[model samples]
Target chain A: MRISELSERSGLPVQTIKFYIREGLLPKGVNSAATRAEYDETHLERLRLIRALREAGDLPVAAIRRVITALEDPGIGLHDLFGTAAYAIGPRVEEPGDDPAWRAARREVDALLEELGWRVTEEAPARTVLAQAFVALRRLGFTPSPAALRPYAQAAAALAEHETGQLREDTTRAQALRMLAATVVYDQVLVALHRLAQEDASARRFGAS
Target chain B: MRISELSERSGLPVQTIKFYIREGLLPKGVNSAATRAEYDETHLERLRLIRALREAGDLPVAAIRRVITALEDPGIGLHDLFGTAAYAIGPRVEEPGDDPAWRAARREVDALLEELGWRVTEEAPARTVLAQAFVALRRLGFTPSPAALRPYAQAAAALAEHETGQLREDTTRAQALRMLAATVVYDQVLVALHRLAQEDASARRFGAS
Candidate 1:
């Protein structure tokens, strides 16, 4: 089909479609001339998946490219794909590790998490995220104290671990661990866990929870 | 006290304290001429809070600044202050009303939740995340197909909502309801529920069901 037909069917604008092509996100159809290109079902299907990961999964472009590449490779696990993407766009802003105060604050947060009896893992980008946040905020003139973060980080770490651990307790759907790894580790850490909190508050007396 | 003394007490480094003073993230302390700034417990408390928000909450500097400002305000509720920060960081990349694909994905995911007999919401930023992923990927070299996504989006929505609901149904975490809101949402959606499947699988294979 022509790009216009593809656009109408996909519900995306022609200009946007062109942007996708230019970004190298979309494959070019057989070209009869300089001005003409043909697209097929492969393009349509790929576009749909792109929309799904981008819109539903909240993946960034660079991350999305990595995910697509991984998905196409057939050898990579889904968990790895998600981990790369989750860390790719960067989480919040991180502080530079070169600074001593930032390092102190980072260590404090970790110590508190440990204090809470939650097993903290280095697997997720929590450390990276914290590091970058400091750097970004410092750039914007914000300083963090280890004292303020200790309890909060511990509490959050405990809660996050609790939430993640709930997976191990459920007695059904246990066989799907592989599928769950990518979906849960990435989604829960990146967005879903927080969403639960947001819903609670909106419903609270405050107005939106 | 000396910078090192303050560092020992506050658990921050002398250098970082200087950076904070320079960056204005921390207020300048009593100066011993132009050579030094003194910090006290108050500064330490403030710094701790800043780190917690940045690391555990993963809040952006701009958002963290707003939170700090609010935290310092006399009239704001403490609960509300934290709640608002969570909302500010939000789901997805957080630009509202700009991405069609994102919105559509949100609606689709919400619909998926509904189909799975779970209480679904329209306010989720998960959709936005998915949308951003699309835009991001399109910026790269791969355009995902809709057929590839429609089913997965639907399945994720259904599975997440259903799984979490089931987990909550059996437990009496009386506050699980509140737990759902005051924390991140996706964690429970993906993590807690996935645990159920894993648990059941473990039971079926490792022990007598």
Candidate 2:
């Protein structure tokens, strides 16, 4: 297929697709003439993956490139490849600042994760994000107890199980791309659903007819 | 207590506290002298709420003022006030674009919510958010079925239940502030936890020693 068809089918502009190819985010199509190149289903799939990461995951070009590079790396196994992609689609945290409150929150988050017996690594950016939320809550004079956090963790674990359970004997590249996209996009979906659910519960309890 | 004391307690600079006062996000302190005003616990609490909304909720000053206005309104019930604040905090989505994919995604999300029997309003910002995520997913060649979405909704509902359950007989002002802050911060926390759990699951399955 021509680049124009790829652009139309992917709903991306020809220039943007050209730019992606230029950025090495997509490979050049097989050259059929001086200026003409032929694209195929792989290009279409890659374009779809790129668009999903950019639009839904809000991942930067650099991160997308990293995930692509990892996808092409035959040395990395399935789990580690997924890990690389997960880390790339980041709520990537800066190092925890040297504030007593932050340190305290970090310790609390670590303790809770340990208590839950979840095997998240120290370097997982989500740990910093979780700690930061705790600090914010505490600043507002509400320290969420481990007991308070338990339900959230439980829900997270269950949702994670459901997400991973979807993976089957699919091709590695396709599965990784799908999983990567789902991880980022579903995070947004879950947030929206939670807010909607909260609104419903508030209406039921607080009388907003 | 003085403005400086409020600043010290809330960890906001004195100038920012004064700015909040000037912006009407906080009421003026009682005048005690020509050059000074007396502050109290209410001021401290308001400052805490302001900081939480700004730092954790990422709410703009305008939105913060809207929340503050709702908080001060005598007629709005607890639920409505919460709805106002929740709307103000926002994953406030733009209206869906005039694209077939987005419209289709919106219908799918609306149907899923109906199937789940949740009493969320049609105007809920989260509805748009959920639809947008679905569109993004579909753009990548995946449309999530309600079956795939059910666990996420279940988790969201359970977490919402836990959050609302915490609102037992606290003063209206304090409870509303706490809930608003939680609604925003917890969304971030939940995203982080889900990612961490995914990493753990990936590690366990994919030979990531």
Candidate 3:
């Protein structure tokens, strides 16, 4: 297939394909003649993966590059590859500034993690994200008690267990990457669904009609 | 209190407070003289609420204005106020193009909603969000079966139920708005916790050391 054919099949512009090649996100095709090259199934597959990462996962080119490297490395186990993808997709949370509210929020987050007995690292970006939420809530004069946060944690843990149960050892690299992309993108979907569900519940409990 | 004092207490800049006043997101302080005005505790409280909506809820000024209006409307019931806030925070999802894949995804979403017996409106932005997720999954060659989405919906519904149970009828308007802001912002917190939980589950099941 030529670049034009690749563009048509992948629904990406030719310039984008060229840009990806230049950025080392995609490989240059084999030169069949002067100014013309032939692409293969691998190119098409890679283009599809790139599209999924960009559109669905919303990952930057650098993160996608890391994922590609992890996929191609024989020594990177499946679990490790999943971890890399997870890290790439998680938002970068900045260090909290020194404030009484932030300090209290950080303490609350540390306690939640300890109580949950989750074996996540101290530097996990998720820790910062949780702390930020607590800080914001406290700033608004609504400190969520440990009792309020426990159910959410249990629900999250249940979903996580289900997500991990879906993974298998025999999954191919492309499939694994696709699964990871879906996992990250579906967080947005889950939030959306949760909001709708809240509306439904609110209506049942309070709606007039 | 003066504008400078309000800014100092709220941790907002004088310019931003002025902008909010000019934009009608905040009411102007009582005119004490030709060039100066006197603010009170109400101004400070409104400024704090605006900050919470902007920083925590990530709501646009327009949405925040709607929320303020709903809060000020004495006739609006507590449930109606929550509904207004929920509608304000839901993301606007663009309609997917007319493709076979999108059509299939939309049908799947419809079926899931019907199966769950959720009472969401037809034009709910979350409907489009769920459809978009399905389309993305299908495009990536990983169509999630109803079996896969069921647990997610269940988890989401459980969280929603827990969230609603926390609301009380005697809550003040400011407290209600704070609850809504916390609810909107806490989605990020929930996703972070979910990711961490997944890591824990993966480590326990697949970790080498």
Candidate 4:
């Protein structure tokens, strides 16, 4: 297909497709003439992945580039592929300063993880992310106890297990791409679901009419 | 207490505190002299809340302002106050255009919600948010089934129940503010925990060494 058809099929403007090619987000189409180029199914697939990551996962262009780079590496294992994509797109937590309160919060998070026996790396960004929430909660006069966070952790664990159960050892590139898309997009799904559940919980408690 | 003391107590820079006041996120202090103003415990508490919402919740200034405005309304019921803050600071979903794929995904999401019997408003932003994720996932070649989503919803409902259980009928202003802060900050907590759990799941499945 020509660039025009590619643009029409992808529902992206021709100028936007050209801009993506210019920005190295999409590979240049095969040159068919001096000014005309032909695109293929790969271009369409890539565009879909880019759109999903940008719109649903809310990943920045640079982060999407990192994920694409990881996906393109044929030698990368499934675990490493998922890890790279996750690290590229997951919410970031700024490193905490040496405040006693922040330190206490960090220790509490570490303790909670240990108590749960969750095998996350010591350098996992989620540790600091959890600690930051703890610090903020404590500042607002609610120090969330480990007991309080356990249900959330257990739920997360069960959900993660179910998600990973869908993965297979001998995955094709296309299948891997689909999984990668699911991995990022499902985060938004879980977030929305949690909010909806909160509304439901509130309705039950307060008598929604 | 002076502005500088408020800054010290809140641990926010003096300029940032002034900026917050200018932005109407924080109320102005009492005028004491030609160029100086005296702040009190209210200012300190507001500063803490603002910092938590900004840093932990990642809410923009305008959203924080809306939350603060809602919080300041003395006659607002607890449920209404929570709804206001949630609408103000929750992740926003862009309304979809009249695309068939989007409509299909939206219908599927509506069905899932109905099947779950979750009592959410028709206009809940989370509905659109969930539909968007479903659309993105489908574009990437994974149609998430309602059965697959049930466990996630159940987990979210249980967690929401535990969280709402912390609220009381005769809450103080401080407690309400704390709950508001919790409402925003715990979203980040759940996200981080989910990612950490994913890491653990990946490690177990792929044999992380």
DockQ numbers for every candidate? 0.07, 0.70, 0.55, 0.48
Regions more than 4 Å wrong, model 2: A1-8, A12-40, A56-62, B18-37, B60-62
**Mind giving the per-residue lDDT tens digits that candidate 1 earns over B4-94?**
7777765667787777666556667888778866667667666655554554446666676676566566586534553455556555466
Please give me the DockQ of candidate 1 compared with the native complex.
Answer: 0.07
Best by lDDT: 2
In terms of lDDT, which candidate is stronger, 1 or 3?
Answer: 3
Question: In DockQ, how does model 2 score against the reference complex?
Answer: 0.70
Candidate that beats the other on TM-score, 2 or 3, i.e. the better one: 2
Task: List where candidate 4 sits over 4 angstroms from the true fold.
Answer: A1-77, A94-108, A168-177, B1-76
Question: Which 10-residue window in model 4 chain B sums to the lowest lDDT?
Answer: B172-181
lDDT per residue, candidate 3, B72-159, as tens digits?
8889977678777766666667785777876777788888888889887776778878888877776676666778787788878998
Q: Estimate each model's TM-score.
A: 0.40, 0.87, 0.80, 0.72
Candidate 2's displacement at residue B185, Å, is 0.9
Best by DockQ: 2
Instruction: For model 2, give the TM-score of chain B.
Output: 0.91
Q: Which ten residues in a row have the lowest lDDT in candidate 3 chain A?
A: A171-180
Model 4: DockQ vs. true structure: 0.48
TM-score of 3: 0.80
Q: How high is the TM-score of chain A in each model? A: 0.48, 0.89, 0.83, 0.79
Whose lDDT is higher: candidate 1's or candidate 2's?
Answer: 2
Instruction: In candidate 2, list every pair of residues with a backbone clash.
Output: none
